[model samples]
Target chain A: EAEVAQSPRYKITEKSQAVAFWCDPISGHATLYWYRQILGQGPELLVQFQDESVVDDSQLPKDRFSAERLKGVDSTLKIQPAELGDSAMYLCASRPTGGLGYTFGSGTRLTVV
Target chain B: GQQVMQIPQYQHVQEGEDFTTYCNSSTTLSNIQWYKQRPGGHPVFLIQLVKSGEVKKQKRLTFQFGEAKKNSSLHITATQTTDVGTYFCAGPISGNQFYFGTGTSLTVIP
Candidate 1:
C-alpha cells in the first residue's frame, strides 16, 4: 500500500525556536491536507492544497505558520518562534483524484518547551 | 467554522462486548468519514458515508449516516483488543476542508 511520508516523527524545541515538518503524499495524489491534533482531541484542519494552489487556510495561524507545496508534490510546513501551545501532532493526508478516502501519514509530533 | 462532536469521549469494553460511538455535526455535511487511530499511530480511514440514511457494514463494524446528514454512528460488535483505538468522524463542509469530531477513545480489555 502506498503511504504518505512524513519526517521527524518527534521534535522537541524551545519556545521561540523555529521548526519545520515535511510531508510527501502518495504519488499521483493532487489533494493534500495538513492537520493539527492536540492530545485527546480530533484533528483540526490547518491547510488544504489542490495541486500547488492553496485551497483553504482559514484555520492556519498565518502569523508564524507557513506552508508550501512548491512542485505540487511534496510539502513543507514551517513555524517560526514556536510557542508552548503549538505542541501537538501534525498530520499530513492526501487523497487521490476520484478517491473517496484519505491516506494519512504517521505525523510529526512537536513538543514546544 | 464547522463543529463536529462525538459522544462518549471514552469507552471501556471487555473483549467480546459491543460498543458504539455517536457523531453529530452542527452543520449539514455532504459526506462523513470515519477513521481509527491506534495509540501512537496515525489515523487510518475506515469508511465513508455520502447518502442520507446510508448504512455500511464491514466484517465486525457497522456505520450509519443520519437521515439529516448531520449525524453518524459507528458500532462495533464483539470488539477485540485490536479494536482499542480512538475513532474520529470527519465531515466535509467545502471542497477538501473537513472538520473532525471530538473523537471517542475505546479501550478493550481482553
Candidate 2:
C-alpha cells in the first residue's frame, strides 16, 4: 500500500523565478528517481539517488537544477531562474530492491511563463 | 547515449479491439519495462521483461522480449476505455542507467 508522494501538483512561475518540488518515496525503498516529461514526449531521467548518495545524474542540467535526498528518505528537486523551456511535469519514483517495477507519484507540473 | 523508440506516436482504437506497440533500443537492454501514463498523470509500471526471447502474460496483456534483447512488444486484447493512456517502454543500457522510450499514446474511443 506504499505510494510515492509529491507536493505542489501544479506550479506557475515566471521565467526568472525559482521553484522547488518535493517527493517522498515509498517507505523502505532505497532508490529514488526524478524525471521531466514535456508534452507529447516520454519522461526523461533528471537524477537518481541511492540511499543518500547519487547514483546517476548525467542528464541533469546541474547549472540551474539541483536535487537532494537528505538521509536518503525524502528528496527535493529545485530549479533556480527557471526558463520557459523548463515547463514540464516533474515526476518522482522509487524502486524496490528487486529492481523491477517502479512506483511513481502524481508529479508536479511547473509552467514557467 | 542510449534511447528507446516506439512507433505510432499516437493510436486511436475502438473499444473491444486489440492493440500493440513496439519498443526498440539503440543498444542492448538489460531489462525492458512497460508503463502506463494517463493524461496528466505519472507513469505507472506495468510489466518487466528480463530474459532473452521471454514471453510473459498478464491477463489481456502479453509482453515479448526480442531474441537479441534489443526490442520488445506489448499486445493488449479487447482494449477498454480504461486502457486509454500513453504506453512507454523503459530500459537501461549495459552499464548505464534507465531511459524511457518516445512513448505511444493510445486513445480508446467508446
Candidate 3:
C-alpha cells in the first residue's frame, strides 16, 4: 500500500534552535496537512495545502513556523527559535481528493529542551 | 472555530469485551472520518461517513452517523490486545478545515 513518508522519526533540540521536518505524501495526492499532537490529546490541525497553494494556516504560528510544498509533492516544515511548548508529535497527512479520510505519516516527534 | 466532542474520554475493557465511542459536534459537518492511532504511532484512517444517517462496518468495527448530522459513533465488538489505542473522530467543518474530537483512549486488558 502506498503510504505517507516522514523523515526524522525523533528530534531533540535546545530552546531557540531551528528544526525542520519533512513529509512526502502518497503519489497523486493534492491535499496535504500538518498537525500537532500533544501527549494524551487528539491531533490539532496546524496548516493545510491544496496542491502548492496554502488553503488554511490560521492555527500556524506565522512568526516562527513555515511550510512549503514547492513542487506540490513533498513538503518541509521549519521552525525557527523553537520553544519548549512546541514539543509535540508533528504529523503529516494527505488525501487524494479534497473530501476523504487522510493518510498520515509515522510523524516526527520534536522535543525542545 | 469548530468544536467536536467525544464522550467517555477513556475506556477500559477486558479482552473480548465490547466498546463504543461517541462523537458530537457543535456545528453541522459535511462529512465525518474515523481514525485509530496506536501508542506512539501515527493515525490511520478507519472509515468515512457521509450523508445523514449513514452506517458502515468493518470486520469487527461498526460506525454510525446520526440522522441530525451532528453526531457519530464507533463500536468495537470483542476487542483484543491490538485494539488498545486512541480512536479519533474527524469532521470537515466550514472553511475546508477539519476539526477532530477529543478522542477515546481505549485500554484493552490482556
TM-score of every candidate's chain A: 0.99, 0.97, 0.97
Candidate 1: the clashing residue pairs are none
As for DockQ, the candidate ahead, 1 or 2, is 1
Could you give candidate 3's per-residue lDDT for residues B1-110 as a string of tens digits? 43998989999999999999999999788789999999888898899999899999998999999999999999999999999999999997757778788999999998
User: What's the lDDT for all of these models?
Assistant: 0.94, 0.92, 0.92
Cα lDDT for residue B22, model 3? 98
Ranking by lDDT: 1, 3, 2
Model 1 RMSD in angstroms: 1.0
Fraction of native A-B contacts kept, per candidate? 0.94, 0.91, 0.94
Which digits, one per residue and each the tens of the lDDT, describe model 1 over residues A1-86? Answer: 89999999999999999999999999999999999999999999999999999999988999999999999999999999899999
Off by over 4 Å in 3: none
Global local distance difference test of model 1: 0.94
TM-score of each: 0.98, 0.97, 0.96
| lDDT of each residue in A1-113, candidate 3, tens digit only | 99999989999999999999999999999999999999888889999989999999989999999999999999999999899999999999998885478999999999999
Question: How high is the TM-score of chain A in model 3?
Answer: 0.97
What is the DockQ score of candidate 1, to 2 decimals? 0.92
